[model samples]
Target chain A: MARKSKHSRPDEAFEPYEEHAGVPMPVNWVAIALTIWGTAMLYDTGESVQESLQDRAEDSDVVAQSVPDEGTLLFGANCATCHQPDGRGLRDAVPPLAGSEIVAAGPDIVSRILLRGIDGPLTVVGQDFDGHMPSFDSALNDAEIAELASYVTTRWADTTEATAQTSEEVASLRAEIGDRGSFGGGAELAMMISSLPDQPPMPARSHVQAGDQAARDLVFAGRDQVWSCASCHGDLGQGDESTPRLAGLPGAYIVKQLQNFREGTRENESMQLVVQGLSDPEMTALGAYYTDLRVPSTARPVLSGDLKRGEQLALQGDWSIGVPACFTCHGPSGFGVAPNFPGLSAQHAPYLAAQLANWVGGQRHNDALGLMAQISEALSTQDRRAVADYLASLPPVPAGGASMARMETQDDQ
Target chain B: MNRYLPLSILALAILAFATLMLVIAPGMQINSRPAPEGLTPYSEAEQRGRETYVSLGCLYCHSQQPRSGDQAPDGERGWGRASVAADYTYDQPHQLGTMRTGPDLLNVGARLPSEGWHLTHLYQPRAIFDWSIMPAYPYLFDEKPQAGPGDVVVALPAEYAPQDGVVVATQQALDLTAYLQSLDRTYEVPADGLRDHGYGTPDGPEPTPSEEER
Candidate 1:
């Protein structure tokens, strides 16, 4: 045989391919790869198929079709500006993200760093780094942040493998901290995050169904032909950037605000005109109409602020600046407490911004004890923007959304 | 030796690998997260308004969710904190749009709380924002010969409003407005920890220390 003699074991043919002496079947790799590329291309794409393929080739890894990890992308887009793409932050200029103790500490500090920004001095990976790391409260949403946190915690926090931080965990941690330092979201404006009890807001028992037939009738049809709440507050008493909504408001609360407008306690030219000759019954009916109508969510912000900052201002007040938490008086969730504070949750940002500016400018002095003015004056324009945007972004607790009723019930308290 | 057996086994293995990497692996990462606390579903009016918003193709110009400040200056833009998944628990169809032709309206309700302003703006974007690129929604309103007792008159500039009549909001306008107004989400989710996030940074204007110290 040709495969003979000189070979030590001539009798042993090339095992499986005995007939061919080990020459294996060649695969048409180029053809197989083209088929995959064609198959993927055949699936729908955005621009023209050709254009999409071209763009995809440039932006994506042809070998791996999945979108890049959110954290890696976020880190590249955000942290890389200073930290360097390799995550070995510029020595002395910025701290490294990879193998950093802060990242190793998990998502809390990492998230906090992202939300509030690091000012003064921060020690990462045992080296003291000091510089202004801008706050991201207004920029990234909680989920995006969570993804970034997970990515960093797992990918860069350490050289060893680690589990990613869940959006829930990042969210909860964000709730507990970020933007709490100054006039912010719902917690103590003056309290530091570390001092917080780590307790979630006390759960309300039940949401009061503020629906009233009289109110609905008054809202849809003009009360005594003088006014229809729907006229100003679009169909369900959903107000815009200029007006306060009456829908889903506590009946008594709406009545009080109306009374405030009428008595010049709340100085509003349009509202004053609307409430000019409204009688008690008409007001009550109107209040009922809006109260019964569900408050729609409206959080379009004309001027952007730090959502994290806004959240901080709304939850915790910058007691350092004498601003109280919005929730202290407005309810733990900014859902209006009966008879006093109106629901700031789901309110319009421009409206809130206007009111805050009015308070700052001393143009509108209707809140009792000049509370609104005092707080407004204390807030810087930036603070106003933050709180307004934050308050505007909140989802109002529905009338029957909760499991139990709050301590202060309408008319009961 | 059935040649089909190895091929079938290979296909099964490929399917298993795909499921493991694409489905199981990623699912294991995000599925553990619980819905954020204090997140409520959209109300009937809000839902109707959301439908209106979708029908109007508002998503074409505006994005509901905000990206990180690192990605964009949206934080300084006051679009609200980066939106989380919990923010869309009730969002049957998630609106994670990325168009910024206009400003982010994720919290527009809180930003501008006026029905009249919104109505007027809808009727003519130029009325409130002179430089607004948004087209007018004249179809959303009815040109009534006279302003009825309870009819809302859109305070449109003479250029937009009919010279002989007032603009009355139609049902579609109302539905859309309701949805627009209900977009506030300022409440701190349980994940944000204890304090809210609305104050100026320590680097900004120095906050005067208050009397009551915690």
Candidate 2:
């Protein structure tokens, strides 16, 4: 054995073994290769781990693979700009789709909105967006309309549990409304559409039996409780001075208001306290019950007023003051848009006057209403009264009364 | 010789790494400095108030940045102008919060000119807003004890009640208020013709058609 000297040079020592080890083998080379390979493997493993963790965190289990495609195309073409692609809508102008009562309301109301258009004062997501939405009657076919309605109901509005509209239903509505111009406003449409022979009675609260019973029980048990839901809101769910009437409101609107109260966003002390104690289920039931209640046409009786003066102010605003015609947005009647605008007809005069005053006084500060305020401020005191009185005296438009052409023209502008 | 060779290589490697880091890493951002008008160096009292605002977690319920659409008439309602990134350049950690339990406070300082009104409103919101559901911040204020028989106390106006002689406004609140009041952006940029037109700045000729057209 040629024993290697202890102090032999590294090159000399390894030279003899190079052939056996294969490739100019040195002790450090093996170590370096192993280290590099190990690092590469570790990096690959890290990337895989990160990918897996991300996938897990995303919890793709809950998300639907693809949102329903039925109404998606139509909604995108017509509704998405204001309502948003996801149906969440801008904070105020358009109501949310995830849980709106209007979406949950029977197909008639939904179809009527599509046939006519909505306008005037309305609140969505606790903020008010008072803008006009054009009707889609001329733009979409009956099948397309039905598909879009179904999509909005099921996918965006989360009323998947609610009955989907059939193409036949859409056809019938189109036929019935043929050549008849758009309905006047939401109120007019609601009244007319509800009276239709094909229209179903308001969705029974019984459908949500568990929720309705629980809410009824809570409300009934707390009947004598001061400031209970029924105290300011009448037993029939009609609203009083301290509160807006809840009956006959689209279910989606009711739920949004309740959520606003609970979250302290609505900013009414009494409502906050009243809603603070309610569980989510209780709120849902209360909303459903109120939405199902019949809206008695007890809108305050039209008071005798200077009708001619009021009509003039409403139709032709005093442009010198920069006041736009009320009819430009509020509609011939004051029914407003279904989901966006509020019904002004038959509303208490005091409330209407107070709101107009609030707008001018800067107490009410909505972006959409801001211009209206400026316009209101320009009006003489008598002008304000005439408009308000005229608004209050007008009857709510019958359902499906708005014209597709009117809606289209409004939307284009 | 061997030791010397290894040491030299290691030193060179370390120097090269250091140089690389210095060249590649981001440098401190100094441009777009916030205007310091109306802002005072932090005082101990103001600092305490700031700490109080933080502890109360007011940011969770309010946003300082107003949306672009909000700039129209909404700004006149006291929400203020849309916030620019430069507005928060000085913040160590920006508090661009989300939530609107109350109105945005970006321009609240200018909106509420009356200090007394703020004090009274904070003590009891319903006193100011009959329908307000906002929680009262009585803890931020000192309640006057019922006047003792011999104590000669001057009745303050219904609105004016200082939290303490040294009013312990949360330093967070004071700083936040200071920050809010500092949001006056009334300087309208002049159109092209109005730009450097012999008013003072040196760089431009007298009014020309192109400048006037602008």
Candidate 3:
């Protein structure tokens, strides 16, 4: 293209335009071979093909007996990052789908991933995956996403029970979830999951297993520099009307609170002082000690709010006002999720309301991704009070898996 | 044979040779490489999102190809290492636009991983970049008087955040953002790929590294 030799120099040797004037060098065969080899390398690996033709062809011979599973293809394309192709995830880095808690937590938990995407640390099989999964809300249609969710849940079942979820079910849930930014990460997803029905029931006994001996000793008798938790909290780990009852709370939640107190994440002069001289083990032990103790009484309403309204808020949140039911994150039956989310089953109303208000005011926000902060800010004081009082009124609830009661929800707000 | 017939035949042969080199060779050169290690095919979502990218005519402003440092200052500008043909293996009608009125998006996903940041920037670019000439795509978002529960509140600057309501990203905007997020080409180029391998074929070992290293 550079030198139109005939056109440029009509006078000079017009007969033979056999050779290119651009370069005197011949084509580099080494370069061409390496290029082909490199290309073959990429093709063999199958990381970046359009249809993955070769992979499909190879699989067709053996693995293609079943109807072309759209979900498998979709998962290989999308969900394989955190959830592997085989669904055996990479340790704490990504969660495995082989009997993943969220995948089988029911359609609402996992289907929401396609629509809103999930972020923050998620606990699957009790291990945390800190990565964020992007939303496919606009990416995939209802039917495609449905098939994908179905594939993962059923194909990866603990016993291959083959729970086939229909596309209609996915369509309905999609319409229900509507458009929201990523379910605001896992805490919110946990809350949403908790609200769904047919959840695993609470344990028979409260499961108040004992704590570390060293920590139990410290709870009763403060070590050299520290004071005991029993000063304000009752000897039995039960709190008075003003103080929060710590008994039977999840160990993770208890430890987080003590850590929060020490770090000023959840500011409290008393707790800060109590935790000041406590070392990591002492703090962990204190958390364990409280968790293991069984309280004689559940939380009661020290101050009054509308019990009926509180119950309504606790059980069925005012979605019109952008408030999710309290138990969504807390737990089914108002008992809290362990470690991070405290059970609200027997929490005192005034204390709960105060904490909710703190979330609104940005005074207390140690919750993952500051989820409580957003939820509380959207709530009015009365809504917070209604939910808190309702929580306090419930009888003691036993700890159970996170799957919440299945309830139909509004599309957006 | 007539002298004019021989001359005409020579002219025709020359013309045919030019066509082979000029018309067909570049096309072959464009696609002669394998996809790089980190490069992945577009997910269904990203594929759907790409439609938004195309429809919005982002190509008019943004380019997806970055030339090597020797050719341009793109490397110094942090556009990433020079793009290779394999980088576009998954791209259909690759968006190697000529005009670069906006930054090259060859490695945007690596540059900005946050969807929120992208959504906000799409809504009103100047909100974040005070001197930006890119027009705002307010239509790609919904303005709500008060954000509903589960609504994605665009993290706009105070000036861009609506005085009365909140702004939530529209599906198109989200799709486009996903496509943008999928525009990563920051994969560690294979040893041969990092060389002067333009079409997965290198003329010589890369000049920067030692000759023995190759």
Candidate 4:
């Protein structure tokens, strides 16, 4: 071994030659120490980064191991708010997905309804709902809608009859609808949806039971202090643009509001003045009479707002700002929930906007459990106007007077 | 000279990490917290008023945050509950201040529900309280010979009233007052909204004396 070069590896002891031979020994030691220090610093400070990287690795590992939970995730994001996670719709407002004849009918019916949405009265499982079901034509893609449809059908439909929806079916349905609006009503839907079972008629609940004749008389003829109900609320109690229509409202809701007005729990100068002279009997009679009256929607979109944006707010809320969809609580088409959430459909746009403003400004404090106040506060002015206009554009609940009366007569037996 | 490259890299890495730890990490944590229930967004008028509040630097004299019971007697001071992170969800560039020159206004709306009182106080602090150290914001109002339609007349005391005209609140004053009125956080705070200071539990202190007296 004649004069081994400094750069060469040692063969005798299996030791490697120093790479940084030109640098000082202390500097070399310092560099080694620094390398350890910097690595320790990175390890200490990069905990979050390390966690995220590991999480990504784990995610990939899981992806390789099993099918993705895309259906469950999509259903949670899209349908869970209204249809509920368990697939039971809210208290007869939204139709239950579980055991639904429509869902069981197969992919065509569900896909069509999901694509175009429904704008008129719908009867599900003997319960009547009049509201707008927003069209997913623009919001969701064919594959996503298919995933949602399949998820709901399988999750809620009878296990033996559960059918899965494919993207091809959704795509075909989308092509056929060709940008048509929501199915107008049950009749129009019946025309489109084949194999859909005949829906049972909704059970009649008496909204206007016979009451004090004296109070009924007071409704038509005003006393010396109070104006007649027809003067502001219309002859048929069909509300105008500002004053709320009393007709078709739930009797209990009307009575509660009247009591709130009387007790000053709810704030309204005109309502306060009107309720001062009315006795309890008169309020009940008026509520009952209004509940009996049925009228067509007279609401027109008067306020200038982005109808598309408004429709989105009414159907799909912006959860980023904590605003929920109007139909979630107001009934499917803003037809109003029975007791607390009043009908927003066909109410004047300006009036709706004003009420929202009142809620935001702390002027109106009678909202159920402060939910409306908090929701109103979250809505921007433009959003408020948009939702109000969209609600105004929705059709009113179909008149069920004749059938309901017949049902009520039967119930009397 | 030869060590410059590695030395610079090490220095840069340290600096970058310091920035991430001190600034980015805290910012992400704050931004991720969901807004507490009952903490609503400001209305248009309230938002405008909040801008006014910021422009006026109301934070200089009045603090919106109250210290915890262990830190001070803020609860006994009738300033309501100790301040929490979720309370400021809608507040951009939070108004938490260190000064106690004036009372904390976190629950001012609940304390002062009268808009007229606020208008009068804004026009001249002495109008309501002769000894109040708060500076008057007279510029927020205008003296008009007669109240115009939609112009809110400030109900000033006879001495504070303009000699020959009525004091009317300008839109800015109304907006600022609306903002102040929207400061009511008296709604029951959710359990998650409380800060665990390593203590057992953070129950909201007794109802403020002012609320009880009212």
Query: Where does the lowest 10-residue lDDT sum fall in candidate 1 chain A?
Result: A181-190
Candidate 3 lDDT, A1-413, residue by residue in tens: 64755565455555865765664234676778889999999987776574576666666656545545677767754566335568887664455778766676655456777676654456667665443454556445677778787777777655345556677877887788765545444566666566322322222232345557677677666543334566446577665333577776777678788788778788654456457667887777777667655443445442324555665566567788776777676754555665467877666554676677667666577888977887888776545655665566554433221111111111111
Error of 3 at A154 (Å): 57
Give one digit per residue, the lDDT tens place, for model 1 in A281-339.
87776655565454436445444555657766776688999988887777545666665
Candidate 2 stretches greater than 4 Å from native = A1-211, A214-226, A240-243, A252-267, A278-292, A301-305, A313-318, A325-332, A366-372, A379-381, A396-413, B1-214
- Pitting candidate 1 against candidate 2, the one with the higher TM-score is 1
lDDT: which is higher, 2 or 4? 4
Candidate 3 residue runs with Cα over 4 Å from true position: A1-413, B1-12, B23-32, B148-150, B191-214
Q: What tier of docking accuracy does candidate 4 attain? A: incorrect
lDDT of 1 by residue, B47-165 (tens): 98788888888999988986543344454444655566557657768666788899888877754555666787798876555567998989999999997887766665556658787
Summarize candidate 4's per-residue lDDT along A1-413 as a digit string, tens digits: 55566676557877776675477789989999999999998988799788898997787677656754888866655566557779877653466778776777766677888887765566666666553465666546889889888877777666576577789989888888886766765656666556455533333334334435675666666553344566556666765444666666666678888888888777765466557777787787776677656555555554444465677788778899898888776654555655555666666565677678778777678777898898889987667766776676655543322222233235446
In candidate 4, stretches whose alpha carbon ends up further than 4 angstroms from where it belongs are: A1-212, A398-413, B1-214
How would the candidate models be sorted by DockQ, starting from the highest? 1, 2, 4, 3
TM-score for each model: 0.38, 0.30, 0.33, 0.37
DockQ of model 4 vs. true complex: 0.02
DockQ top scorer: 1
| Per-residue lDDT over A1-413 for candidate 2, one digit per residue giving the tens place of the 0 to 100 score | 24576664556546554334555567679989999999999999999999998886565533434444546756754566446787776453345656555666655567767765554333333444343454556445678778777777666454436657777899898888775544333434346434322222232234533446767765444421112455335565544221354553444445666676666544444455456567777777776665545333233311222445555666666677787766556543344443434445444433455456656776455425467678767765445545655654543332322222235346557
